[model samples]
Target: MSGHDHVRFLTKNMRVDLALIAGMIAPGSRVLDIGCGDGSLIDHLFQTKACDARGIEIDMAEVTQAVAYGLPVMHGDADVDLAHYPDNAFDYVVLSRALQAVERPREVLAQMLRIGTRAVVSFPNFGHWLVRWQLLATGRMPMTATWDRPWHETPNIHPCTIRDFFILCEEEGYVVEQWLAADDGGRRTPWRRFLNLANIFGEQGVFLLRRR
Candidate 1:
C-alpha cells in the first residue's frame, strides 16, 4: 500500500504519535520496527513518509494482520533476532509501547542504537499520578487503555519511570533529541517542567533518541 493510504487507515486518536513519527523521519528513509504489533506504525511510515519499513513481531495473530496489509513483517522475538541485522542498516528503529514488555530493555535499546542512526521509543508512563494513586490508595495495579491487562497477564516486564528512562539513556550513551508526553487520547501533556512530579501524573511519554 502507498504511504498516504497507510496514514488514512490510522484512527484519529493515533494521529498525535503519527505526527511525532513524521517529525523524526525524513522522506524515503529506511525504518525497522521492533515488536511491531499489527504493523500499524510501519504502514503509516510507508504511506505517509514514503519510508521503506520492515517489522519484527512475536504474535502470530498480529503478524497475520500485518501480512494481510502487505507489510513486510517477520515473526521473531526482539531480544534474540534484532542482533542479526547489520550495523546501521536503518535510518530509524522504533519501539512503541514495546520497551516495557521486554525482559532486557537496556540490551534491546543497545541493539536498536547499533542498527539505526536514531530510534523512537514510546511507552505508557507508570509514573502517572493515576497509576500511583491506584497503587497507593487502592493497592491494585492501575487499569487504563494502554495498560489494561491484569498484572499477571500483562506483557510489561519492566515497568519504568520517566526518570528511569533518562538514567538509562545517559548510561547507554544516548541523547534525547526530542521528547513528548501524551494522555490516553494521544494529546500532548506538560511534562518538561514537572517530569519528576508530572510524569507520575502524565499518561505516556515518547522520546526521539540518538546514540552519543
Candidate 2:
C-alpha cells in the first residue's frame, strides 16, 4: 500500500507510534507483535506495507477481534509462549505498552530478540516529572491516563524507568539502536538526550534494539 493509505487508516492517537515502528521496518518484512491488543498495529502493517504479520495476545477478546480482521494471532503470554518460535523467525518483534505487565521482562526480551532480528518496545515512563512530583509530594502511587489504575487493581507488575530498561538491556546483551520518548497520546518528546534522567521526567519511551 502507499504511504498515504497507511496514514489514512490510522487514528490520530495511533499515527505517531505506528509511524515510528513503520519507519524501522522494511516493506514486506515478517513481524511478530507480542501483547498485541486488538491487532491494530499488525493490521496496519499488513494492509499498508504488505508486511507478513502475526500476533500473540493473552486477551481472548482481543484475539477474537484480531482474528476478525483476518490477522494471524495466537492466544498466549509473552513470557512463556515466545519460546515456541525458532531463532530469528521474524524480521521484527514488537512489545508495546506490555512489558510493565510481564512477570519476567528480561527473560521475555531475551526471547523476543532471539526470535526476531530486531525488536521495538514501547512503555510508560515511570520517571516523568509529573509522576515524580506526585510521588514526592503525595507519596501515592500514580494514576495518570497511561497508568490509570488503583494500586490494588493495577495490571502493571513491573513498572520501570528508561534507565532500568537500559541497564537490563546491557546485562542481557542487547544493543540500543534508537530511542524515542512520547507523552500520553504518543506525541514525541525531547527526552532522548536525558534517557537515564528520563525516568525522573519522561512520560513514555520507545526503543529500537538489536541482539548483540
Candidate 3:
C-alpha cells in the first residue's frame, strides 16, 4: 500500500513544528513539501484532510522510501529546482527545518512564494537563551534537542534568530500571516505578545508567510 493509504495514527507522532504547520493549512488544498524528509507530514495531510500532497527531498534514499510507501515524492534540490515550478501551483509550500541549510535562503523563499499561495517555514532559533548561556559559559557552539549536531557536522549553514527572521520578512516585504515560538519541549508561550523575549527564550519558530 502507498504511504498515503497506510497513514494512520501518525499525526500524533509529528514533531511540534509539523503539527503547527498542519494547523496553518486549509483542508483539501494542494501542498508542496520541500525538503520533506520521509513524506510523513504530507501523507498525514493527504489522509486526514484529503489534500493533494507531494514532496521534494534531496536525499535519494528518503525519496525512494517515500515513493515506495505510495507518496508522490521526487528527488530534487530545493534551491535549484524551485525555479522549475510555475507560479502559484500549490496552496502551500513548506520548508520545515530546512531553511538554514539551503544555499540561498532569500532566493529559496522567493521561489516558494512564487510557486505557492502561502509558505510555511520552521527552524530552530539560534538566539534562544539556552543557546546564549551555553555559548557564554562554554565559549563553544551550543547544542539543543532540535539542533543536536555538533557545529562542525551541522547542515545549518545560515542559522538565524527569530528576530532576524522577522527583519528579513520585513525587508523582503513578505506578510506574516501567523507565527509562533516554543520551547524545545514543544510548549508554546504568548510569543506574539513579546517578540524580543520570545527570540531569546524560544527554542524554535514557525512562520506562515505570503507575498505583500
Candidate 4:
C-alpha cells in the first residue's frame, strides 16, 4: 500500500507523526520501535500491516500496559540497551518523539542504523518560527502543542531543528530517503519542499533514513 493510503487507513486520533512513520514501513517487514510508549505503533503495524513489530520502552509502567494488551514490548532504555541487539536484527528501527531525550543522540542514531536497514525518526522542530519568536520576545524557552512543557519539567535535552538533523545526517553519512514537515493535525506543511520555509513553519519533522 502507498504511504498516503496507509495514513488514511489509520485512525485520525493517532499522532500525525506516528501515522507518518507507519506509512513509511513496508507491509510484513520487521520493525523495532524504541521508546514505544504503550506500543501504539507496534499494535497498528501488527494488526494493519502484518509486520513483525515489537517495542522497547524505558518506562516499566508502559511496558506492563502494553504486555497486558498482548502486545510484544519490553522494559528497556534507548540510551544503553540498544547495544544488546545484534547487528541488522530488523528491517526498520523507529525512534519517534524521543530523540531529544536520549543522553547520547549521536550514538543512539548510529546504533539504530546498525541494527536495522532503515530508521524512521520524528521530533518537534525547535526552529519553528513560533519557537524563535517566543524566545526572542520573552527570552525564554518556547512552548507549543508539540513542545508543551516548561523548561524545568520537560524531558527534552538535545532538541534540534530540521536543519540540525539534516546536518547530522550529512556529517554521519546517513542517506535521507524521504522527509517532510508537519503539524499534529496531520497536515503537511505547505512549504515542506522548501527547507528554509518549512523550518520556520513546521511544528515537527519526520525523516526516513538509511546508511550510506
lDDT of 1 by residue, 29-86 (tens): 9999877767878888888889999998777776878899899998888788889999
For model 2, residues 1-212, the per-residue Cα lDDT tens digits are 11222112222234447666776778899999887667888888988899998998876776787799888998887878999999999999998777787778888888989999999997777877777778889999987766676877666778888888888889888999988777766666666677665566667778999988
Question: How many clashing residue pairs are found in candidate 3?
Answer: 1
Badly placed stretches (over 4 Å) of model 2 are: 1-16
Each model's TM-score? 0.87, 0.89, 0.91, 0.92
Q: Per-prediction count of colliding residue pairs?
A: 8, 3, 1, 0
lDDT of 4: 0.85
Please state the error at residue 184 of candidate 1 in Å: 1.4
Error of 1 at 47 (Å): 1.2
Better of 3 and 4 by lDDT: 4
Error of 3 at 26 (Å): 0.3
Candidate 3, 22-62: lDDT as tens digits: 98999999999988877988998999889999998877777
Q: Write the per-residue lDDT of candidate 4 for residues 1-212, one digit (tens) a residue.
A: 11222122222324667778998999999999988777899999999999999998876666788899999998888888899999999999999877877789999999999999999998878999989999999998898766676887667778999999999999999999999999767678789999999899988889999999
* Best-performing candidate as measured by lDDT: 4
Q: Model 2 — which ten-residue stretch has the worst lDDT?
A: 1-10
lDDT score for residue 182 of model 1: 76
Pairs with steric clashes in candidate 4 = none
Q: lDDT of each structure?
A: 0.77, 0.77, 0.83, 0.85
Off by over 4 Å in 1: 1-16
